[model samples]
Target: MTGPAQNALYAALFGDPQTEALFSAQAELAAMARVEAALAVAQSQLGVIPADAGPAIAAACTALPIDPQDLTQATAQNGVPVPGLIAAIRDRMGRTPHAAHLHWGATSQDIMDSALALRIGPILALWEGRLHAILTRLAGLAADHADLPMAARTYGQAATPTGFGAVVAGWGWPLLDQVQAMPALRDRVLRVSLSGAAGTLSAMGPQGPAVRQAMARALDLGDPERSWHSDRSGPGHLADWIAGLAAALGKLAEDLLLMTQSGIGTVVIAGGGASSTMPQKRNPVGPSAMVALARHAMGLAATFRAAGLHRQQRDGAAWFTEWLTLPPLCIAGGALLRTADDVLERLTPDAGAMARDLQIGQGTIHAEALTFALTEHTALDRATAAARVADLCAQALREGRDLTELARGAWPGPDWPALIRARSLGQAPQEARAFDRAVRAASGGLDQGGS
Candidate 1:
């Protein structure tokens, strides 16, 4: 095979085909070819190179028939792919004058960086749509389960009761943050790089800025005004987005893993992993993969962070580190979001299971609500706690009795039933509705030709 299967058995579980293509050698070569063509055109328009050579240069950039094996061998010597690619284009151009202008006044970094911007533009856009869809799905779930009462756990123990919709909202809100943050991040990272040799654009003269602007316009990328030869902060923003996304999805994965535990059984997912030996096992296959990908991405993102420390005007170490790290990150980002979306689509909440879990603590989960009721009736001295209500709640839990019954015995007039009722998801239902409303507004904005 020319490359790894984009969606082989293992890959399909944690890879995105569209994004995988974006980082392919063919895609990289094609992007660089387009940048070279556009560079020739821009230079031609400025009366720099022969205008007649522009079309020929563009024609030579056509992909296919060019072997990646050849480029790989050439790259070993040249330290970059453009020199090999330019040589191939020139050879394909058949000793014509147009071949002379194939990469006029441009360095390998210029071609590669500009091509990366050209490629990343669409990649960012794809993620935007994906994130928006995930958010929309989460918002719908939140609205549908606004009153779903589930035991909210803290430090791995049931602390209180909360709406499952609120839990879904917790998974979603960070993604909305990412969705809301994408435009700015795109502007930061998808910038055209046209500073030749050492970022001075000394070869292009006074027209360098104009050519950069023209190329940015042609490639549909942002122009960074100054050249970013060693300034990788642009791509760093992309790393932040990728890492932030993984962390958010990791949270979702954690919750799903916990909720689908054999004992909890609160989350019901389709296509769970089956055991080879143990027929009783229905493993959470998708959540496990997504969580693994997220953790892997977190480590890779740290590489990008460490990559920020470049040496001098250019550091081969950092640049090469990015080459090693960034592409996988983009791929993982696509995969995580796609898997999370699928996980949500097939996910169902076992309401009965959640209610049953609330009983496991034998009414100790209602201690907070009981405390509030107690506080409502009378004020307590700062040190009045230890032996009084604590013993009652502990006794209730140990004896498999209801704390509400004990509280009712004590207060006599406090509406004890209301305190333990599922209806007391204080402000959770309203927050769920608010998220639903926000999603609707964003959708409407989209329909009305806004972001």
Candidate 2:
């Protein structure tokens, strides 16, 4: 019911404690202070500010010399928290000669955006770690179940027989792509923003480019080489990537939901939610949460992309829209990944249940395999074989008998049981092992070390 990761009621369900702290108000204040300190140092080194002022500001920032509560009212009046933060830093260094050089020529957007990059550095690392963990688990699952036969469903109906490993591979392939894209995303999105008042370093004069590059070095971020005050592509790209990751997790959740349905219990998730009145209920709570979180991230991502319409040099309305949406979108993505890792760790496939569902419609699941066998092993043409197979499938359904049993009466040439077993899992095992191989190649090994 509540918004924001700090919501006491839904924090655990929809927010990741670690990532939430990274986006908290106090953390934001500290990050902005770090940006200010780094900017002062960079400008001082470039002879744009007093050298003593740089060291003094750095010391004040290291001390984090301000109360976050004091900025609430000031931020309401100033429209951005950077001004309040700067004023607080000045107050903390009263009577100090170097305090005058605290902010130097940098603008509010520079500090805030650079601070966001600072916090995002560690957040990206955390997300990559979680992503690698999930991939490792999925690779194991695929390898183990590569030969385990199960019915593959399409449009809510059994379409063909596939190994459970192939099903697992389907869930992990997109994740593999996400992990691979992390390096580029980090490089492009995590950069310094050092534009002056109007996308030009007019205040810093001729030394602006050097100052920005020095600040980038001081803060361990990439130099954008130009102002991004009016260009929201970095944030837009970040939102798109987060939404994509959420969608991947959502697909996995949806599949788990169907697999755990009552009549088709192919997967059993541990620690499912219990019904208040129903005694024998084990609800798929984790998967359900992931699905909901994915939807939330998707909606926020659309809004964030729309907010990229930065008008002229700057647009307060569009900027404020990002402030409203980006934090929750990031939180939702983190929570989805956390939930997926937990769900995968606790998941157990029910081979018996899968086998039972494979024959749900009187062995009609083998219709494709039967048709293929007739053409390949006998003199029957493709059309004749298909029609004959369809006819036998109808007879088996009408009489409530196995299709293979009826096929024996129709075609006695091919070894029916062997043919069914051979064709039931066409390339499914290969597909699963191929995924495992890819994970191993990408990760160096399956030891869950790094991405």
lDDT score of residue 81 within candidate 1: 93
Q: CA lDDT, every prediction?
A: 0.83, 0.89
lDDT, candidate 2, equals: 0.89
Residue lDDT tens for model 1, 1-451: 1222254657777778888789988889888989988888888887667878887787777663577889887898777899988888888889797788777777898898888888888888788778778888889999999998989899998888899888888888788788778769878988888888877888888888888888888888888999788888888888888999999999999899999998899989988889999998989988998899899888989999889898877788788888888888888888898898888888999999999998786777877766665665557532343245677788887887887788778768868768557345787878888888887877676567544
lDDT string, candidate 2, 1-451, tens digits: 1474568887778889888888888889989999998999888888898877788888888868577888989888988999899888888888888888888878898898999999988988889889988999999999999999999988988888999999999999999999888878988888999989899899999999999999999889999899999899998989999999988999999999999999999999989999999989999999999999999999999999999999999899999999988888888989999999999999989999989989898888888988888888899999999898899888998999999999887777667978989878999999999999998898873255543
Worst 10 residues of 2 by lDDT: 442-451
**Over all chains combined, what TM-score does candidate 1 have?**
0.95
Q: Which consecutive 10 residues in model 1 have the weakest lDDT in total?
A: 1-10
TM-score per candidate, chains pooled: 0.95, 0.97
